[model samples]
Target: MEDPKRLEEGLGHENKDRNEQFSEKDDKTKGGDGINHEKEETNTVVVVEQKGDHKQLQQQPLVKQKTKRVATLDAFRGLTVALMILVDNAGEAYPRIDHSPWNGCTLADFVMPFFLFIVGVAIALAFKRIPKKRDAVKKIIIRTLKLLFWGILLQGGYSHAPGDLSYGVNMKFIRWCGILQRIALVYMFVALIETLIIKQRQSVVEPNHFTVFTAYQWQWIGGFVAFLIYMITTYALYVPDWSFDVYSHHKLERYMVKCGMRGHLGPACNAVGYVDREVWGINHLYQSPVWSRLKACTLSSPGSGPLREDAPSWCRAPFEPEGLLSTISAILSGTIGVHYGHVLIHFKDHSERLKQWVSMGFGLLIIAIILHFTDAIPINKQLYSFSYVCFTAGAAGIVFSGFYLLIDVWGLRTPFLFLEWIGMNAMLVYVMAAQGIFEGFINGWYYKSPDNTLVYWIQEHVFIKVWHSERLGTLLYVIFAQITFWAVVAGILHRLGIYWKL
Candidate 1:
């Protein structure tokens, strides 16, 4: 009979030595036929080969572990939020720090748009983690509703302590629309487009070689559409008759007159208050009785000390900074932020060359040039001009990219810990500061020494006394009060482990 070992050895040179060894072992244990043992051994070899193949199949890509530090993005967001708090709560907004009046760009102008943009970046990051389409849609709806509800609450749901509105004829209508409300509206619309519309379309296609362009192509298209729609709406409202000279028509002024005539004169007898009447169209659209009731109250109090009727309506124009038309530009600003986040995530592995930085810098420079020429697209925060959007977005992108490089790429984090800490609980600080939660505690009531009560002394003596000659100093004093308030609030929030989420 042919030897089983010899037959196995003839299969391959490598197998010959392995087969001889196995045969020797089998002979020592000889409780069965050699051919039966050889067959069992061969089956074991096949099983081992299959197990090895399975291990290789289960291995994940190297990139999975490497790309997990999304903390950098969160840190970037925190920095932006911190800057917002700083600017919003400046000790003294010297011309150097404050935004330009209406025509030019400034550091202050970048804060709001940067916040919105960061929101967009967050939106992009969020949709990826959610499991089902229905759940995502539900989350989007809930978030939008909560934002709107809180926005309205902040405007004046609790403007007066419970029964304060009951005082003989004291009714104040807090302006209906505001920053948070606008953010809610825009976010809702964007989320709807991204989740329900865009994702549905993407699901129908083949899975393997999915392109980012096809998936998020709608964001770009939608951004453009938003810009165009806003621009057209603003143009029509600003110059209803369609005259070449935008100044000739003054559609806003005309609208104000129409609003005033309708007896919906709003809070103060000023242009901004009047414009609120037009935008809210509260009487017509929502059937809001607040405007009409307030008007009646004012008329009833004919002899009351100068019932706000004589206040120059134009004075309200400055208050227009937070208004309807401007919100359009704000939404566009968020879109720009979304674009930046996309680039950062997608090109993380690309060469970190000087050319990439320079290219971004140049792109911003080009935008600045275009803004300089297009005076028609005024850089007005109140109007939310297209030029304002371009200038703010460009500046914000440069700042964000610089911070990303320094903190994330270069690993320089320790130096910015305090700022980062303050940033982490930013919204908490803002609400606390805005609500005067710590004003009495920090604003000099606790000080034993007369001179040590810096805030009190400044407000009563230096600000009201020594600086009495300059109006600017008084404004600066208010800013100083705001800053001191924030510092105390930041310290407290840091200690409490309280981080406010939106």
Candidate 2:
């Protein structure tokens, strides 16, 4: 029998095992009257041999059993992680793919929601059969705590900038929220909701257009409730004028901005920033936001350059991208992911699952377009707007369904096998690659000057000189050097059965 304790990785954890009893009859004419039957749990194949033939049985070779898993899920996760590394490393040279300054969506914007959506899907698969609710909830809490701990240690101003050699962070100005922190919050709430409403998941399959919604109605209701909370608070909350201190040219400067608005969605007067400032403290928020690259804030519109001489007071105020009020809408993204995951679980046929996913995906996209075109709620990633949730979640559904069609149904997993390796060990890739830990370590060994390092040399000489274009060179280096390198690293780890789980 294969080892029951096999490792299956994702954004979080996903493990499944089933036990059943069965009997198999073999031919009784193999030079013996009786049969030597071997049976195991979970629909394993039975190998029959001669009852009194020890020498013949000893000559048999070992056979390995493969674990059942959704190959599309791992491939999708790997694609997302690979995108994260691309944007994080190459966004400086390529501004269009980077995060949008304020009001629109970009390639970088999809990474966060993709992660949250993956968490929701993973939760559906992970909690498919929870015999003990108490133990499951305990595990969820522990995983959430672990995510929060790593989020703070890695992203909470504890480490220096990628270029800076210094270490340590000021306790007063350490950020309290980040990418992993947001993921933790979304995971905890969504997992608890799914656990409480586990009874709603239908046991029998109903292959209808609306069966997915009907089966998990409570989850949609919870998602709607969260949406309403965010909408109401964003529209009704009164944002007072705020001020913050910034150190410019070795001098402490205080700047004030006038708000006194109810529903201002500007970079400075937004309710999301107001809530984060009030709850987490201005000093504890993200100091450098992508919004600083806005034309009104800096001379450069998309690329980050010097601040404009006539920049507004809010330009200097720190704003948390993963703020508190904005997280409500993010929950809706997770809820949509749970819906797609439910489709995977309830529908056995490939066509049926794709139909459900396509229907939901198009429905969300239409709603997103209506909202954005009508100016009701423009798709804004920084705020995690309602339309943003619908747009990103819808896109995720369509993409995942496509992956299923290609990798799972069509049986073409050869090209995407590299992505599967990264997906299986996504947590390790996140820490080592996306977080720049690996690059920082490599940068530690320099020849003469502090800037003379292997990574820098490759980017400057091998990539930059080959193309004679900074942007193109940086993009290619990220694709080949970082993304491809990590894929190989993850592949090796998967081969060795090494996974760093939260």
Candidate 2 per-residue lDDT over residues 107-145, each given as its tens digit: 999999998887788777656656667776887788788
Question: Model 1: per-residue lDDT, tens digit, 318-417?
Answer: 2445556556557777776665544443443323322343355457657765766765444655456667777667766666666666665566776665
Alpha carbon lDDT at 45, candidate 2: 49
Error of 1 at 177 (Å): 2.1
RMSD of 2: 8.2
lDDT of 2: 0.79
- Which candidate tops TM-score? 2
Any residue pairs clashing in model 2, and if so which?
A: none
| Pairs that collide, model 1 | 91-479, 91-480, 270-313
State each model's CA lDDT, in order.
Answer: 0.47, 0.79
Which ten contiguous residues of candidate 1 have the minimum total lDDT?
28-37
State in Å the error of residue 134, model 2: 0.7
Model 2 misplaced regions, further than 4 Å = 1-68
Best by lDDT: 2
Q: Total clashing residue pairs per candidate?
A: 3, 0
